[model samples]
Target: MDLQQLPGYLTMALPLLAYAAFLVVMHVGQRRLGALAALKVPLHLAALGLLLRVGAANLPTPWPARLLPYSEALIIFAGVVLIIRAVDAIGVGYLLARLQKRHVPHILRQGAILLADFIAALIVLRQYLNLDVTSLVATSAVVSFVVGLASQDLLGSVLAGLVIGVERPIAHGNWVNVNGMEGRVVDVTWRRTRIETRDGDFILLPNNVVMKDTVTNYTLPSPLHRVRVEVGAHYRHPPNQVKAAMIAAARQCPEVLAEPAPSVFLESFGDSSINYRLNAWTMDYGRQEAIRDEVNCLIWYQFQREGIEIPFPIRTLVAPPPEPSAHEQRQDQIERIVPLLLDSEVFQGVSAPDLLAVADRMNLLTFGAGEMLFNEGDHGDSLYLLAQGRAQVIKRTPEGGQALLATLEEGQCLGEMALLLGLPRTASVRLERDSRVVEIKADLFRELIRAHPSFLDHLSRLVDQRQRANQELAQALAQQKTADAAGGIGQILRKIKSALGL
Candidate 1:
């Protein structure tokens, strides 16, 4: 090992060491230059260094015979890379990716290629040394077989994963539902498939279970789904009325499609209500629950307008609530008179004391479920204030069609427009599901207005635009006759000339 005795060995090893250093430098360059640039420049420089080292080591040298095995080293290197490139052409890694339902990273694909290199290096070693690999191979086989038997579940998982990789029931980036867990497939590793749920939680399903259990892939072909909203309406209203209203409401929504068309089902009947289900189709399944909530919210307000009662589980008692104290009763009575304030246009003219005196004459009344208190077009006798429960105002159109105009809840007042004027009722007033209402009749309101006759000036001016229909028609007919006699074109020309000061 003296320097003079092996100077050629030193010469050959130094260039090879420099070549290895170039490889290290190329690796760093790859990191800094990024994946794309590294492929262009660093690889060329490193390849140049490798060729120079190989050429320098091969030339004749003033060295010992022990050093010149450089020929075998180059041969073995080429053999290994050749075997690796060949195996890569077979696309073993691509097959693995297909089976696992995942995209294989480039580095992992190269690692699969490296398996060929390892075997190639070992074959070169055996060729160079005349060593027997039979005993070593036999011992390794025995050890692997023992390990495989002991870890049966682990082997089973790996084999099942390979099956999934081959069969591809699910894939990364696909939204899937497995055993009720809705999630996006995040990873397909050696043994498990990872799914990340909408709530940002990760669930790892073992390859074996994923292969065996029921799995629903939403991202394949199309991911459209439907949302169901259940509503209960009182049996007093026909099921068809409620269904038509719900379908119309859903159809109006921009998110719901017209092609599929929303449908309603009369599910069943409860003790006091009929169960109705509204099924709406949506392509955005991720927002399925949100869209369902939004549809129901709109339906609720629409039902009120349609006079359909949304029935809930009602807990009515046979015994009434404890009677209120005399003071509470007085306060309640005071609240009843509050809506009568709407009856006063006098409040619009005269100030405080006049309005207070009018409110004082009001009284409250409670009506049970099956009550019809007033009919449409009948004389409006009272302005009613809702205290509890609900009431629906029914309006009849000129075309003889009936529609529910409003649902009055607690603190709502109805008949104000009728009481404001001494006119016939515009709507039929009825108790909606047993309600308590405070009534301020027309006589009391008139007495209040009579105390202040100047209130008429305000009322007359407010209703000035609303003249008799016959008067409007007669004036219109006369104007039309004059225009026709004058000739329609000449009349229009004269009107324009007059307007422009011709």
Candidate 2:
């Protein structure tokens, strides 16, 4: 190799080597860092080009004068490209990181690179092209004004986009209400923002309009959003019961958050029913409709099972009154009670005639669903046979909530302990639906026990078995074991004998 031409050869060889290294770096960066890699490509190119220009300038045998300018221009062009790319990459990376909860410093780094590029470009232009950019700009005021006027809206949008990008007022995945349209932000660009609406349609809102319009970013401070649903139920059910049902329904929805917890409010009393609202928090606005639907569906089923009536609008028509007879009403009541008495195990041994006679004496009481028949610890002198519909036995818990102990359907009995030992009611019993119950008074039982001495044994045995069954139910629920359930039979017998003076 000729030693004198070594600088020229090295200039060429160094650029080729630099180009090869740049390719390797780009490959590695693209594989690992994606777009961030493109940022360094121009830098490598600029460095190699500068090296080539300087090496050629100092060569003992310099390149031809005509080729000198071209070579230097290429170096400056490479530097300019690197500067522009650095600004764009840094700015975009910062914006994306801010949107995604990733962190990057954008303004300082991007501005510095941009300023450095501008100075370098000025130097390159002055040194090579013999041009003054400042004087050129000063002479083009009319052209600048015309361009600005023509792209006013475009400029405004770009400025707005810059503001949003820097301030981070809205981000990707944010649930927002823009003007009257509600949607999730899909992407934000220089001139427009893309929003995916609840209807699954994408809407493009101009950046300027997005900045000017009223914006409600639901996920700004937090993603958990509170939503409320209004509903009406019949006035028969108590407020506490209604509230419990609504909250339970809200909690059933998987999208609902448990930390904040669900709540119910009594809004108002309507003409025919009570109005209520259920409030719950959910993070997914995308599935908000489904969440509400699931909650409402659960509420409907719960209301049905709890016998909570949801009233509907009804229109009335005038009609003439027909015949009314007290005898027919009394006969209906007797018939209603007869079957109930025959179905009860307490009257199992009694003949049909005797049962019918007893049914005639028994009082037929009616109760609407959700009506409390008797409360815990309330003095009761009668046991009830549910003749139609069902009833729920609810025991009050220490937490001020009600725990359901048992469900009594048609032919089932409740408050039996009241008549058996003449004790206070142990738990509250509420009608689960419109129902008629046969009330067998303590006096009636005393009279029947006195007439048939042998019947006392059967009655005592029945009472004892029922007490044991109740204890077992309590045990199954993981409750405290029942107290003193034994000897219920003897106690009932003694109480009946003493009351009847037998």
Candidate 3:
């Protein structure tokens, strides 16, 4: 190596050594490199450019001069690609790793790479080949003006996409309503935004149109979305009563959030009915339709149980049959409940007249599938006798999960111990299908027990036996022991007397 040529030699040697080190790093950390693996193409291009430059230097004088510019141009292009790849790998992959995000906006990344390549090309033409870039720049401006005028819509859409990328008003997986089309954002590109509707159809909206139209993002700010369901009731019912019933119905749905809580607003007084809106919140915007349906169904059942009639329109052509009177409906319910009361073990010792009297006072309520009648540790003031369909008893384990304790079918009773002893409910009961249950309030139960004191002994023994059976079943399923049931009858009798103030 000549001392005078040291600077040039060192400059060439340093880049070669750096390229070799990069190659070694790529080979060693290929798995961890992720998107950086794309650097291989530029690395190969740089190697080819170096080989071409060396070969051109040794060729005939005119040939060496002719090929040198082309070789330098190749090297410049490869250098631009390498710089862009390095920025993406470090900025997106490494910096965003802590946030668990590994993505950069595609438009921004592509634009940056294109801009760098354009600048590199200008450098090669002006500096390396000694061509005047001022003339090229002037011609490009004129061409860009013509292209812009011809593809104004396309340019507008591309600009809109850039704005969207920067603002981030909506993102992938966000549930949004653009104009009238409601769907989840699947992909966003320079020209269009693709949304996947609930019907499994994709809608491609131009970015310009999306920017012009009103966009409702249900997933931004937070995933919690408020859904409203409209319902009508006869004007005869009080506003508070209807509101309470609607709120209660909304709470029964498992999808409805309890923290923000559900609300009911009396919207307006219609010609034939009072229109009300039920507002409920949920994180699942995709299932908003289903949640609304469930809330509507529960409201209908709750209205039926509460004797709140939903009036029909006043403009009917054909005459509809008159609804049954309150007395007639009461008689029908009592008749249905009488047989169920007779079949119950708790009422076995009571006379038929007494059972009929108890049935008359009881109220029959309907519940839809998946509705929770009561939850574990809830304060209970009534007992439920299943008249139709099935229900599951679920006990919450220590690990915050639920275990099936048992299933209750028709003619079976729940909340008996809670009602008799004034204890909190032990487990949650959820209806498996549309079901009906007769509710026996504490006052009615107290009246029955006071009238027929002998029935208490029989009820106590029966309750004790049922408790033991439940404990055994629970122990078998959950592999957990329950409290001892010995002398439970005596304890139950004392608790019943104390609860009822006998």
Candidate 4:
């Protein structure tokens, strides 16, 4: 505890105490300042350097004393790295906090650290070690030239990477197409950018090549991406009608954006048909293919409903098959419709002649999966008999969410109440699978009733029985309990007569 020895002890303990404090700070700030993880090597070097210096001062060995200069150099290098890392962490942390982003670009951060390391090394050599850095550089000029010449491509890639980092034309998670290769950017490094393709393949493109190639970033400027779908329709249909159908199809697709409403353009007149272009915006670039497929399928269904033909090419002159006569076509349709009508409980007791007449008047409409046959609150005058696919009856709840009330399979009927009363559709019917529906219009029902007045009683009783058996359907149709109690069959007959203007 002598005063003279206290100074010596303080000198020995001060550096150790300082190193301990730095370790604590690094540990505490590791989560907030991610850059501290890069300090592992330097931290180890600092410990070894401190130990070497201490041994040289107290070991009473000439060799230890001689190693003091090299140990001091190691300590200086470690100190420079520590200072650089600290600055990087603070600067990056501030930027991320202000910008609310997870990180700065990888190239910029690494490049800054490397440049700082080079400058620190030169200063340490010239100032602390007293080596003439100017002479050292001059002596290595020829070697530097040789190395630079050999790594010209590497150097170019590094520069290009720097440019990319600064410009930020592409970033991680961006969906981009470069030189016909489309993928999501996984990582960007000084030499190469890694992209993950949709097929789960990783592609490494050198930064120079990426910079040289034309790039299309679907997720830049905004995440919303515009998709174009081209289709051909028969020239018989007016452009406005075709456009309306195409736009409707696009809007029905769940992937398409509604804000910037879908649009259609008449592109050109083709040899066999008129070509149209549909432009829709969607934020999901990953599902681009699926979205396009859905839109195309929907367009087909819409065209089918609108009686718009996408004509076939007339490449070579060939004799066409003779068209069926009107009688033959009606017979074919009757055959298809009779099987569906026979299976339905609603048409149970109708006379054979009346059933045949009703079948002739009914039209078969095709709908694609996920297509709405009729949405709730729509004014519908046709009753749909599901003949070939599954459908879901979705009722909008009071809370603004939809509830699946029933799933309709083959031989099921919908819109009975709406068809009878000429009221708005009470529930939405969406096809779960591609469906063929026999749509019986109000005029057909009125014709049957006018010819046979007993047909009205039979139809009304059938509808009432079906509604009473299915409480969910009744509630969805908002059928009042009082109406059922006050002679449901009679009320329906009256409503049907009034609705059909009998």
| Number of the top TM-score candidate | 4
**lDDT tens readout by residue for model 3, 234-263:** 988867789989999999999999979999
Ranking by TM-score: 4, 2, 3, 1
lDDT of 4 by residue, 1-502 (tens): 6886776677667777877887778788887887657887578678878877875685446877687887898899999889888887777756663466665777888888998887888888787678899888777887889988999999889899998988999999999999999999999899999999999999999999999999999999889988889999887786777888999999899999998999998899998889999999999898888999999999999999989999986655779899999989989999999888877876776677778977877888877678899999999888889989899999999999999988989998999877877778878999987789999988887777778788778777876777777676577556544544447666777877888888
Scored by CA lDDT, what does every candidate get?
A: 0.66, 0.76, 0.84, 0.84
lDDT of 1 by residue, 125-220 (tens): 567644466766788789989999998877777777776666677877888999998899988866788999999999998878888789998876
Clashes of 4: 0
lDDT (Cα, 0-100) at 41 in candidate 4: 58
After TM-score superposition, what is the CA distance of residue 155 in candidate 1 from its true location, in Å?
1.3
Worst 10-residue lDDT window, candidate 2: 473-482
What's the true lDDT of residue 133 in model 4? 91
TM for candidate 1 is: 0.44
Could you tell me the TM-score of candidate 2?
0.49
> How do all models score by TM-score?
0.44, 0.49, 0.48, 0.50
Residue pair clashes in candidate 1: 98-165, 99-164, 99-165, 99-166, 100-165
Worst 10 residues of 1 by lDDT: 464-473
